[model samples]
Target: MTPEQILPSPQRRQTYWHTALALAVLAAVVWLARRHWPMVETGAVRLAVADQGWLLVAGVATVATWPCSAFAQQGAVPDRLPPGRLVAAQFAASAANHVLPAGLGAGVVTLRFLMRCGIPFAGAATAIAVKGTAGGIVRGALIAMLVAVCPGVLLVPSLDARYLVAVCVAAVGALALLAGPLSDRCRRALTALRAYLGAVHARPVRAAALWGGSLAFVALHCVALVAVTRAVDLPLPPARVALLHLAASTVAALLPTPGGLGSLDVALALALTAAGAPAVAAASAVLGYRLLTVWLPLIPGLVVLGVLVRRGSL
Candidate 1:
């Protein structure tokens, strides 16, 4: 049969676009990795795991992030998911997040999973939105608490007010342009989101799970960072280290890079240095942190992703 007959037009177009986007994102990741390979290599070689026990704890914390994420995700929705499958989907989502920028990969996977569980599209989107909003609030609260506890620990240089103003103006302009076209859909989505949020808040159990899971997720990540610092014998206080990580990650999340690969490594290393860690120690900690959180689980995560996709579970 002819090519047009073999595959329908819209589906074919979507497939091509997806393939192109994937290739572009992959290329960007590879380029960034290659550019930053020296630091990672040096850090890996220089790392001295002082205590195997601490390293094990770090690994456990890293593994724990998946369940934390799944719990938060389930808490966003009213329906209960099959526990094992929910965790597995989250594991797979982590791998996917490495391939796409700005957590889009994870969002897509979670959206699919929610749909498979019988949620309508609007409801599923609302759940994801609620989870993300709760996470942001928790992260901000943690940062604020840490900063208050350790005043002047995070000394990020001030940016020009004009630059900030310009960025804000541009963003507002873009949003204004899009608003006219998307107002109807935006209103519908917002209404649905408000309703879903109200429902979640009405249920104390789900509300607690949502906030608790969000806090746990960020805490575990900090704990993993602490473990890496100890693994390398970096002389930074645990609280300070956690604060620095939170600040750096919050900044890096704006970059839209896959898993915050290149941007996060540099930002985190710099943040550590600013927070009083020596250059070598900071680099080592960053490298070790990424190794445990991203590189190590990557292969197995992808394997799980493949299994899920093959079974039509993702």
Candidate 2:
């Protein structure tokens, strides 16, 4: 048989390997969870999520974060994708992220959505990177501030050390952001981001409103987390909890795992324990929080994505 007749195409090979890797990783996580399931406190998990107020707050935060994040992502694409279309694309991508293993399936789906909306591949790629990376920068700054304001937070052991690392990283990262060519690179990566902000720059009143709205959106999620921790009555102090959140989220963002699922859980558990909370309680709270914050929005996002697609808005 000729080579062409005997061999699979390169695209098929790529797809096969990617699927295999994803399956392997999923199987490993399942096995690990099953093996260690006994260590988790099922009862605690149940109790933590029962607080209606906290759950409501978490939902609000998750939704609010989307728009602020979308704003951050705005200018990254060229005019190929309109703002409304990009929003639909983001929602669709987020929906895919929850169902797809390894977390990148959603990103790929989103990239395709952008392309469909007329964004160049290069611009889409850069925008995704910036949109994701900017959150880390914000978290790192928050952690550094915490370290200075509440040095006692360092006593949390696992978290304190991470806070220190974030402080250093933030300093270096900020310097890089400010560096001339690097700043320009980031600007190019977020073309829409620049356009949106610049268009409003002259109107200080409007600019202030945008900044305030964005800040409120980001803060709501953090507040929700804090509220959940309190609702569960976890032993950790509020300051320490905030620090842990900053560190865990930053680390999770860097993690290769989809949505930082397993990694975020482990980090939260450790941070809680280190801050002197009972292991089972911490596990339960973290699990409950993830369900509310991550899995909950996922359902609606999927539906929205479908709507967008059907309407040809995505």
Candidate 3:
């Protein structure tokens, strides 16, 4: 082989190592967490999952979120890929998030899968970017509304000042991105984003649909959280539970720990305690939610990835 052909490209090597390191981290976290599984499972958990009715509702909610989330991502695409294939890609991506660190595995997998399906990397990236951006937007709006509408309910004295300051800083940053010279910068960013989407799909409506779908998908996730809490007979109000869910989920996404495994549990527990839920209940609720959502998706996603690779699609 030619010298150039024999050597791995730096970019490809970096991607390979990045994926390998991420997978290793995810596996280690999963192993450690499993060792503590018994501690996480208490009598309350049995009682919680025993509510077959609500558990079923939660399952449906989780499943429904997948497609909606996929659509939101699809919205960022300029045109639509085949719906069946797109859905499969989303499921596979879901699986990646379950097994990988910081939820990046799935995003990487999604980008690759779509690219193999003849989508441009730029468009696929844009679609993913839009989905992520939309999620941030949704969460920010929710947090702001909570602070405004239920100040007493959510405003802990210790956190309130920090929270407000953070919001102000974020607002200023957002404003800078949206106006004056920043407006041109914003357009450039969006234009780049659009280019990525175009690489996947050229149709605007399809991209919009995906974005909308992604939002609905996230909303379904929140519903699943509510359902899990109800199944456990937790007495937390729905709105309160939703807010906690949002906070924990966002934090989990930010965490470098695989699938936000440890971070997710801790975040949920803290959010619950902060909101005044009993410790045991908070832990159980978080555990139950992760069981249905995170752990459940990994195996299938890996399987799909294998299948796609075998089919020469990824």
Best by TM-score: 1
Candidate 3's displacement at residue 84, Å, is 1.1
Candidate ranking under lDDT, highest first, comes to 1, 3, 2
Scored against the true structure, residue 272 in model 3 reaches a CA lDDT of 80
- TM of each candidate vs. truth: 0.82, 0.67, 0.75
Q: lDDT by residue for model 3 over 1-314, one digit each (tens)?
A: 86458656985575567567656656765785576666466734564555778878988998887778667766766555667767777787777776665667778877887787677776667667777877788777876775665556555446677888999999998887668867777799878766665654566577567556756876788888888888877778888888777767776665466677666776777788788876666767776788788777768778987887687666
Report the CA-based lDDT of candidate 3 relative to the real structure. 0.72
Q: Clashing pairs in model 2? A: 75-191, 75-192, 75-193
Model 1 poorest ten-residue lDDT run:
17-26
Could you give candidate 1's per-residue lDDT for residues 1-314 as a string of tens digits?
Answer: 88799889997786677556645655765686688778656776767645677788899999999999998988898877888989999999999898777788899988998888889987888888889999999999999999988888977699999999999999999999999999999998778777888888788888888999999999999999999898888898899999999999998887667788777887899888877787777888887789889999889999998998898887
lDDT of each: 0.86, 0.66, 0.72
Residues 1-314, model 2: lDDT tens digits: 76557657995676567566655555766786787687565735556456677667766766666665455555333243465766666666767776664557667766767666666776567556644555555666677887787676655436677889999999998897688767777777467666644654556544444444445545666676776776676776667787777777666554455666676777777777877887777777787678766787777888888887787664
Error of 3 at 72 (Å): 1.2
Sort by TM-score, best first: what order? 1, 3, 2
Off by over 4 Å in 3: 1-39, 43-49, 156-191, 194-204
Clashing pairs in 1: none
CA-only RMSD, every prediction: 4.3, 7.1, 5.9
